[model samples]
Target: MDSAVGRCREIRLRAYPDGMIQPSDLTIIETALPEAGPNDLVVRNRWFRISISTRLMANPDAQAVEGIPFPALRPGDRLADGAIGEVMACPPGSGFEIGTFVSHPLGWRDYAVVDAGSCVALGRGPIEPAAYLGHGWTAYAALTRGIRIRRGDTVFVSSGAGAIGSMAGQIARRLGASRVIGSTSTPDKADWMTAELGYDAAILRNRGSIADQLKAAAPDGVDVFVDMVGGEQLAAAAEAAREGARFVLLGALTAELNVAGASIVAPVQLDSFQLILKDVTLRGYSADRDSAEAFPEWIAWQREARLHFACSTVAGLENAPGALHDACEGRLRGLVMVEV
Candidate 1:
């Protein structure tokens, strides 16, 4: 153990958020570090991810979100998620050396005492600590395994400027899609998607009917739909889907983050006729299941600079709550991370 190490600061849920998360809903507290067990490693977290899933987990009433293995948080409980950290203390024979950077599940804190089995060593490389927190694997799995982006397919991703959606657009293009389109809340974000994220077109959800905008963007109809922000987007994508199209259901940000007291079962209206007449195949999968296979491929893409990591970074642990709030509210683009 480092002689200078002592107590650590962590963010905890102050209350279950009603709808939009506020900074006041979380509090930072100091506590003594836990004693390291024989198989445990103490780490100093460098960066922690702030995501919509974190927002969903903060809701005590929200049901267990699919694909997230962690339990829902209660008042005074520490917020936990993907984090990159340097090992400070580890038991002999733990196979992890001090100063090794590792990715773990304990986050929203300055330090963590995690099981050795849960930590994945990130060798010193050109990849930054924050890059390890990117949702590239999620996007990779959704594109490759969820539906398999076919050559010449026109793909539409909802919330294209989002953490996963941003990566989805680029990956879809790399997977041989002829045209990639994305829908975002603002024109600025839509422009960001088309200009920077390799999208052929961007649809502004705020400008007019999403269906109308999508129709104009893909007049030939979308061959693949990556539905992230459900509700209106899901309905619109269904309407604009081409014959024999594939729909990959990812997240439901609009209903989950916006509507107060909305359950995971929030109703998504889609035309049943479109599904049958167009022979559209809608599929949803847990990212966790595909991560094992997707991580290696995603890493290869990163090393080759074939993928772009769009990220918004906040400098302090104290600001994690507000960063998360921004992420949930669609103010931040791509993966939002906090430097702890």
Candidate 2:
């Protein structure tokens, strides 16, 4: 019990360069127990979600995309990410108590000292914390803010089996989309998307041309596209887009391919004629900013919809590097989580 109540282990980035992330670039350091300040609470992290963009923050060659609020990390800085944790300590009137489940943006560590007001208590529920961290509010935000989901629209989601994509496919159908198609790299993922995730069609990205796959999946064209992997996928989306379609640009999982000299210029190139002639409306999405505005509605949706999200977890603090490496390399599917 004492071991669980005290000091914490943190993963710190030592150096960042382009290409694959090495375990050596990260170092684990032990520190004294984190003390909560006024209006602050200390949480013992239960899970941390590993994402591609979060790994890119540790890459020196990664250029920050405009309008994306990537936390600036220095060599000695603790890598910041999203995690679900339990409040271990809080101020007397903080409204949070020991064992109260909470979520925060500070991860890559065993403990988080987060502002009391900023922390959200998950309360007693069947909703798993890992699910909340992965696709809970983000799924709602993606549908509402990323693009207006009109009833009976044909929706296509890239990276369809991953956290956001999985949720997008289901949510679009719930919102009355006539057909929901997904793009995935593996045959297993494609099967999972169409079978388990309720996607109407699955386009295997590695099997052949993405454009060709999309064309076959939705011959009439997609009315909305939820893009999680930018690059050729984006171009493919444009090619398969219907006239007046809405394209929601969410994540650039492959943007590292364009990283050069501290700049990320035109990492994703879309066909101009397809976009122009189709009169496509492109919108960028940010869960962090959009979530705050939709928090109340998101909470309501969670209860009403009873949505479920799954994660593939890596155990222990030491294995965080391996999880991050897998995410950066596009080797992992769904939400890559770390259980502390």
lDDT of 1 by residue, 112-199 (tens): 9999999998865444654478877787888878887889999999988988888889888888999999988888887888889999
Give the true-structure RMSD of model 2.
2.8
Per residue, candidate 2 scores C-alpha lDDT tens digits across 1-340 of 1355577889888877555667777889888766668999888888887766655677664455554656656688788678888777789977788877888887889888899877888864444665566765676787887788999899988888887887788888878899999887777777877778888889876687988888888999889988877877888888888889998887765654333422344376667887888899998878766555776687767666755565678999899988877766556667788888
The residue-level lDDT of candidate 2 at 10 comes to 92
Q: Please state the error at residue 90 of candidate 1 in Å.
A: 1.4
lDDT of each: 0.84, 0.76
Identify the runs in model 1 with alpha carbons over 4 angstroms from their true place.
Answer: none
In candidate 2, residue 331 scores what lDDT?
65
Q: Candidate 2: where are CA atoms >4 Å away?
A: 1-6, 61-69, 124-127, 257-263, 268-274, 306-308
